[model samples]
Target: MENSAGCSVSLWQKIVSFLLVIFPILDIYSVGIKGIGIGSIILCFILIGMGIRFLTLNRSIKLNPYYGFFLYGLCISLLTVLIHNDFSITAVAIRMTYFLFYTLLIFLPSSYDFDIHFAEQIYLKIGMAAGAFLILQYFSFWGLRYNLIGLIPGLPLNYAIEDYVEWMDAYNNMYTIMFRPTSFFPEPAAFTQYMAPLLILVLFTNVGEKKKLLKAAFISIVMILSTSTNGIVFSLFIWILYFVYINHDSLKNRRFPIFLVPLFLFAIVFAILILFTDNTISDYTVQQFEGLFSKNQSSSAYLRIMRGFDIYRQLNFFENILGIGLGTYKSYYATGVLTVYDGETEYMNSLSYLFVSTGVIGVLLFIYSLFYNVPRRSMASHALAFLILLSFFSSSLFNSPTYALSYLFLLHLDSIKNSGD
Candidate 1:
């Protein structure tokens, strides 16, 4: 009976690990019946079961200091809601649910006794699977002129082709036809954001050099095929950092400039593509790169990077400090209660959303919580945290459980390393 029980527990652990591996995809709106994601529903049930199990076993719930930070932020959000007298039950409930999801994710690893190495392997494999699917997706479009995503049946009411397809005109005629592979995500950019930290782990952490390069190459291809400005720029930034800082020690030990070889090969391949191919994708990429710096009000670059700050500037002094309230930004923006820039349609940046909704104090507490446990000696930990922080400026993923889980996993890995050290 004891052996059987142990086997059952192990099986459940594997199930949880698998669920986490695909959690981002599972969290998509199309994967759920309503506004709630399938991932959330499953996790909520797991949380309840775990809660009951803990009670039956008389287990003490171990709390991290970050929990206090989250609690404080929740209090601040409630206060903001009260201050504004915008007590919409649905809105407050949604915000509360998000908080609960974050807390549950934070509790997960410890409760399940998740092995960091095992989790890394699972994440790597799943990432590879996503990459393989993306490649197949790309070819299907290239050859058949049909998006394989359309073949997947019975998506929820919220699912739409426009959510996954990148319109050609959006790139200002850089390409006649373009299909971005999302690989189970609502958009390609979300897929890239989900994969970014995994890329960092593969490149910077203590993985075998050959394995690292292979995995990095595959992941980089997926990011490129996605054609997301943020993904491409992030990939370039991390690769440069890897070559400069991470590879410096190895370069000093080796006589040959082996590291520079990859860059040279990449340049040659790029030149060949520009010279021989239609160069539509390359031209579109360059246009987007330029748009990143364009002063045009209608540019996606401006809206994603600077428009949030522009919106924040318009807020009153008190609103700037304490925020308007939790979950109020969407309604305010939709109703034109909040002043927006000429081309702004919605909040794309998470930092801006946090600033406008939770105010300065909430933002500080949240940031502090993520970094509080990071060991100063662990460069990998710092790099992981920095990448996550940078991603906030690109999208409104502040409430995403996948991002929360990534941070939690980082802390778990850091704790194990610190213990070994």
Candidate 2:
């Protein structure tokens, strides 16, 4: 009976842990009352429970060296409330809540027996399932082709009617009527950023050979079908970097002839695809390539750079150093401080958003935490770091639950090393 009870408890623990591992994907489509992802809503409760458990287990919270910098940044964000002459404490409180959760996750004691590799395996499987949906959608096989909009009560799921349909129409007008497979995400970019790391792991890691090859091909095709410029570029960069890294020793030892074989084959296949695949996908990629140099395109990288400078020039010395404050970009610009380009576009780059929201001090602190504080000795860690950096140019990193989870998971992995287990 004692043994049976122990087994039951263990099973429950595994089930809960697995749910936590897949929370990002599960919560991707779910939004809360405050417009936050359902996964983040669930995460708050999980953090609280874990915090209580830590206390019960008599585990002391050990502060990392960078903790002070993080808190200092948070305090600066809070100062925005006063700076704005708005007495509302909610904005500052929300920021505090997020960082607090982040800190707890970082400091909480981890189970020695917990298998991170197992968690990563489960994550990849979930990603593959999501990728399958994207593939079906790409071929117009009757999948979710509209923005998932609505509020699911008693759960943190909310969607809004926005530009998704209009954007699809524009794409149809520009290229073909084929829909970009967003899976369950709000947009193609979100889908790509969330899936990129998993796809990289499956393709490049020393996992099951047959399974990896199938997954790699599926994911690569899905990404191309999505036709997100940043997504395709990031995925391609990851593949090339992984190939070179794995073959570095061999190539350095004068195996250039052998090294060129795989490179040549990959180039040939890519060229053939560009030349002969359905014009929609190929043409879309070609357009993105051309847009790299064009200044008029909506998703122009050049426009992002120019806009960054424009926004910076608008800020006063005080505002530039300390930021206008969190959540004030729209209002700040609307108040005739400066005319923001495309008044409707959300933050184009995470790093730029950080500057706009938190100023230089905050960006420096984040950078330090990202690079100097984390343990990054392993190839896996380095790969994740590169993906995160690549993603910063395209999306808001901290706001996205999946990206936040990925970074937090890195901290968890780093904690294991710090524990010397």
How would you encode candidate 1's per-residue C-alpha lDDT over 1-82 as one tens digit per residue? 1121123236656666667666776666444444566777777776676667667777786666667766765676677567
Please tell me which predicted candidate would have the highest TM-score against the true structure: 1
TM-score of each candidate structure, all chains considered together: 0.83, 0.78
Kindly report which residue stretches of model 1 are placed more than 4 angstroms away from their true locations once superposed.
1-9, 29-33, 53-65, 111-113, 157-176, 244-248, 258-262, 265-277, 330-337, 342-345, 375-377, 415-421
For model 1, the run of ten residues with the poorest summed lDDT: 1-10
- What is the overall TM-score of model 2 with all chains considered together? 0.78
Per residue, candidate 2 scores C-alpha lDDT tens digits across 1-421 of 1121122224434544465566655664444345565666776776666667667778766666558656765776667666766434665566667666656544452552223544555677777777777665544533333433212213333344323355444444543454355675655766777777776556545333556555665666566556677666766776676667656544456644544543454465457446644566666667775666677547465455456546866788877787655555655655666677665344447777777766777677767766664566545556666787777765556655666556655554542221111
In angstroms, the error of model 2 at 261 is: 8.0
